[model samples]
Target chain A: MAVTLKEVAERAGVSRSAVSRTYTDGASVSPKTRKKVEKAAKELGYSPNALASSLTTGRTKLIGLISNNFHNPLFLEVFDLFTRRLQEKGLRPLLVNLTDETDPENSLRMLKQYSVDGVIVASSTLSPEFAKAFHDAKIPVVHSFGRFASAPDVHVVGVDNVECGRMAARTLLARGYKHIGFLGGPKGATSTIDRRAGFMEVMGQAKGIKVKESNAAAYSFEAGRTAMLKELKGTHAEAYFCGDDVMSIGALSAINSSGLSAPTDIGIIGLNDMEMAKWENIDLTTIRQPIKQIVDSSVELVMAALEDSNRHPEARLFSCQVIERGTLRPL
Target chain B: MAVTLKEVAERAGVSRSAVSRTYTDGASVSPKTRKKVEKAAKELGYSPNALASSLTTGRTKLIGLISNNFHNPLFLEVFDLFTRRLQEKGLRPLLVNLTDETDPENSLRMLKQYSVDGVIVASSTLSPEFAKAFHDAKIPVVHSFGRFASAPDVHVVGVDNVECGRMAARTLLARGYKHIGFLGGPKGATSTIDRRAGFMEVMGQAKGIKVKESNAAAYSFEAGRTAMLKELKGTHAEAYFCGDDVMSIGALSAINSSGLSAPTDIGIIGLNDMEMAKWENIDLTTIRQPIKQIVDSSVELVMAALEDSNRHPEARLFSCQVIERGTLRPL
Candidate 1:
């Protein structure tokens, strides 16, 4: 048995409307009456059901947080920040794991059933259309760690992967490595494609520089290791920019197994300076994607859209910088 | 504007009761009427609101998935398995990140507000009373990776940390390590306490075997490294069974920085056999805690409790085994 608002009102000696107003957000209630209602509610162990109140307010305060990559350690930080920030804003995250399913229609339908106030597609690998599906369904949506565009169909918050790639290339070249390589993530992923373009763009213009490029099956350690093993078999470059931090760790493992060490026999750099990248053992030099800022900005945009659904869509991109460690050779 | 069930009923030329029955689980509706309602609903773009229907059924199909340690990588796998498994069962995971908060009262109040159908407390470090709070509030709960109790206050699913500790001690003894140590997690965690008891029990019985014991601040890499670095300052044990894999990797890092290496100047073993433990760069010897099986069983127990709220509390413990790798010396 649970306590009801009417029972709390009776115990507090207040009208039902007063009790309801005390619980509703942004509703006016006098201090004396609100204190009485809160005391009675606490005594009766009554918590207004969010779902029941949502029927009246049409705001469930539930945000559909969708992500496709769970294997990447970076996402753990992503999830931590998103959940905490959303919680701080009095919103709950309905975590939707898209690791297996790819169709946006199914997710949109599920979110619609729950009547979530908005959706945050928190994945770089997921296409922009995935976030658009929510928008088309009349749901406020923001894509975190998504691709940047001058004009966007939905609110986008993330880093410039293309610039990150160019920066990685330039970092390697500045280290005086005549032959450099790019080890990207999955071939079809937008992040991989964009980063590869930037890497090629910089390396192609360099004089007397030899460059090689390849992609791993996924942005995973095993995939990077597997791809690197193949590269080692056929004259690998002097150094490589291996996708994200996880993949770079995998590539470093492959190099170590091949009787080679970073900055001695070969050099490696990664993106997304995740926590593991700075491990005393891994000590991976990486491009730091401002994950906290991206997640916070995404939450802000979604909250704004919730207040006014007609807000124009925009892309907010944060810059990345090289976090020098042990993996890269000194310039 | 969103479509409504009444519109779908009107479009299908069926009674409103027929449309509602078609969507309600286990509600009887004729095959022809169900087909008509489904087709009309699809055409009208009507998705039955779960929160609205909860008013009638009193079930929201939302599960509060709570955890305290997001920094530990093992939890990434835990979250992935829990989210996917909960989704397969048509339940949405309301992820509660308690990385900062520790008060069970706050979480209990929050979950009650959401009216979650059930709760899953997935953490070894969290106190047992945390799960008990949910049970006290008449919320069905299952604690994954929790300490084992023959008479659990709630459904508990995980390994016996004490036995795991014994196994780790025996494994080290078999490797001919004379001086051994137990570097546990936080001193207050039940996992750390039970694991220490088991480790001391075995080591205490072995005559002429020296045993040293300490604890990391938390089950994290930095804590492990810091604790191990402190140990290395004095006459360190010949080998150590760190709290978990992440800590073991940290201890290894400390040893490397100290100009010592595993299985040569020292030995190390860990628990949880997390993904990173098997990385080629790490190759940490560890005890395997079957994470998938634990998560699946926890879900099952919580679901079963949802169906029969009067069900008696039960504890399901899985056995853990040593996964031999490069960290420990050979037998």
Candidate 2:
């Protein structure tokens, strides 16, 4: 049987209330009683039950980490960073994988059932409605790697996809590629739409620079390869800014399979600059989104919300820069 | 204000117990009352509180999914499968990232505080002590991708690493590779030790087959690359059986960087035919560990343990087979 708080209190020669206060954060208790309670608890191998204590404090310290794109390897980094940072702050991450989920109701129900103190919707493809649903439920939520909006109803932390698209376009133009294309992620994704907007806006300014935009079914290597293969069969661009690193790697594979090579037959740039992009074999030139910073800030925001649910929603945008490698041609 | 169960009961024109029974799984409730309760719940946007019910049922429905290696791309697939399967069973996944964690006590304390129904230690590199700690704490646990023994102290679901190593050796020998090597992960890892043992056992039987063994710091691309670079500086083997796919890919990169190529200068094979192994760019010949099966079985085992804490600890070993790809020379 698990050791109880009563046993620790009795062993420490202190009141049950003192034992509870010692375990409760910011709860006042005499130092002598606290030291005795701690020693007794340690000896009895007793861990304060978060559930039992939550009934009193109204805080579970459980954060719902919701995501949809598990197939993408980039999320591995995101998950790692989020979990580590949350763990450091003594907050537990309850991961909710929304792989086939289209309705946000299911996720909202699950989070509510789990009694999560807050939630971090870590996905770019998921519609803003998903985040708004959590807000409507009055749950503290922060969207990580979410689309940038002039006015966000919920906490938003990520890079500007539009600016990333503009950077990709400018990088391709400087490389002297008159014909360029935007191979993006899912067509309906806000990130893809915003990126395409920025890319087209820049290309339209430069006369004689014809740009075509297309999208992969998903942000995966297979989808990227298939989309690039289809593009190769038709009018191919001299340079292409693939949606993300995974897609860029896929595009490179498709080009190689067709007896064509990057930077010679075609130039490519990617976003996110995932760890795999830096592999000597891949060496992809891409836009580096500050993934670590975004994750840290998101965790911080969620913690702040936990402390004050009335905390006003804020949008924290991190700047992304070009990371030159081997995928794109030299300017 | 959030809608209360009391309000839902009053609106449904049914007793509070009747309304509670309607929401409770397997609880007895009349059809007419159930319909009325459901209607009232929908109208009030009332979702059952899992925590409040958990206090009565003594089941939190939260399973701690623990992992140490987020750097390995293979984990993306593992996490995806585990989370999907857990959610399908109406269980919540509390992800415990032990990337930098060395002490099992910390994890045990955290899981205890969370009051998780069970835990799934999904790692090959983490020591047996990690899973044993959970078991000792009276928590139901299934170690997925863990080392299997005839008499396991804790429930284990994974492939036999030793047999996999023997298969790799036989494969390399059949392909007429005289000098072979074992490029494994960390020396302290159970997978690495077991795989090396099997590889040496098979190599011992074959005459005129020279074998050397080395290990990477960890099962990461950078570690593998660094290990292989050191090997290339000296007399390397004609072929190598890497610890895993990521390591194999790293070795391939190192060989290419040194102006050497696989199947010509050297051949390579790896274990865990992860999604990336099939990428046209990597195309690694590897041993498929049946990750989906292991993850599914792990979830099943943990769920069963939750139902019956007295369930006997058993080892569920799955078969691994060689996935022929472009890494190895055609026989």
Candidate 3:
């Protein structure tokens, strides 16, 4: 027993077309008629069905937000920001979890069936080809936290992981850590590859500094702990730069379990200063990625592409900075 | 640049209706024709648009997955499971973030506009009325992590928070903690209220066991830390049963910052054994709320409701158990 638009139109003493126009965005309707239609609609508890009207406008106002890394705590912030920004724009976020998905063809087919107006692929681990597949399927797509390219094939928004790597390496060296190591996330992730490259680039130039590198199976606490435990078995470095905050916390747990404390026996730094990084017990000194800005820009880019499918693809990069906390040793 | 249905039909030497029926679920078509249509569609890169087909079927197959607590790590798992399950059913999840939302009218209106087949309210903090509103609007609704009722207004699936509270209190008493405290979530949340009721109920029965009660503004690390810091200014309890694991971790941080340690200087037990609770560095003893069971049941209820909107609403409840970890003192 839902109220119908016809009843609302009859109650408002307006034509059905007028009532439809009043509710349709960018449709022509007088202010007085719009007010009358809105009042009647509210009184009758009538909500215009977006799906029914999408046939006329050919826009569903639904954006597919695809991601694969739910285990990473950093995604909590990413999902929050993406949903909020999309809601602000009156667009609904259709969350697509690719946790076990590898083939872009299946994802592309599924998203196509949903007829999502655009897509925001929010994952660092997902390859660029994933976003490219959506674009090739005639869907507007933006890859948030995707790799940067000199000439991008799709709309990309994220930080320079390579620069972040070099920065982490230099930060450790400047802190007088002669023996340093890079504790990275999964070896397959582009983020891990780029960050590792930058770390080695800077470490290779330094003299009298020994560097070691290894990767966690995933960007998770358990993986970090497992990888760090193996490193501790051998000659551990004076300091280490973990790939991300979750991994850093995991590595920290491994250190504490071995009766060693941070900044005293060993120092550690992480990336993506997630909320957990500031917790007093896990006060990890880390690099802060502009998550909110990146998400907002990704939404904006997708919306723009939706309006004009022919728009050239571009990369929007944000800067990352170090957040000083309890994990890093004093100079 | 997209292949049309007519092109695929022509290539397969079949009628366009046959091609369309081939894409529609459960639509009748000959097997030989289906094979030919599928082969041609694959070669022509033809994908049927879900939005366009919704005009005929009146089903978008989009379910609204609404949540309010993005900061709580438990939601990460909830979202992951919900999305994966929905995808398996060929249903899309439209994520509705009610983190900043206070008005039910606005949220209900937004969901209606999308014409979602159903709505799943996956939050313990949101009021029951939120789900009722959707049901009242004739939208199939399921409440996950919601309070259990003997007669539910809508489909309800989760653990009995009151029983969990009692479980925590008994665990603490068993560990010889005489001076105990209840660190709850927001004051208005049903989970917090029920948990407090059960905790106080158990403590009231036991003599000579002093119990203090306080609430964090939300089930978040910062809120938990802030509340604990305030409590620490005065005489603190021998142990605390936090409303959730994230808050427990926050309280643990506050205790550590005050030169105190858990299980020795102070004891802490949390509810919802989130992934972080098991982290070695934050080995939080917590009550494990069966998140997977709750989510799976919620999905089942919502899907059932969708198939038969007239189905009687029911409440499904799961039991909670204490997971022994490092946060609480030994017996």
* TM of each candidate vs. truth: 0.98, 0.98, 0.97
Candidate 1 residue pairs in backbone clash: none
Ranking by TM-score: 1, 2, 3
Fraction of native contacts, model 1: 0.88
Best by DockQ: 1
Q: lDDT of all the models against the reference?
A: 0.93, 0.92, 0.91
lDDT of 1 by residue, A1-331 (tens): 5678899999999999999999887889999999999999989999988888888788999999999889998999999999999999999999999999989988989999999999999988888888898898889999999888889999999988899999999999999999999999998888999999999999999999999988999999999999999999999899999989999999999999999999798999999999999988899999999999999999999999999999999999999999999988898
Candidate with the greatest lDDT versus the true structure: 1
Winning model by TM-score? 1
Instruction: State the lDDT at A272 in candidate 3.
Output: 96
Off by over 4 Å in 1: A25-28
Which ranges of candidate 3 are over 4 A from the true structure? A1-15, A30-36, B1-7, B10-13
* True interface contacts retained by model 3: 0.96
Looking at every candidate separately, what fraction of the true A–B Cα contacts under 8 Å does it contain? 0.88, 0.82, 0.96
Q: What is every candidate's C-alpha DockQ against the true complex, given to 2 decimals?
A: 0.91, 0.84, 0.84
The TM-score of predicted model 3 comes to: 0.97
Model 3 CA lDDT for position B68: 94
Backbone clash pairs for candidate 3 read none
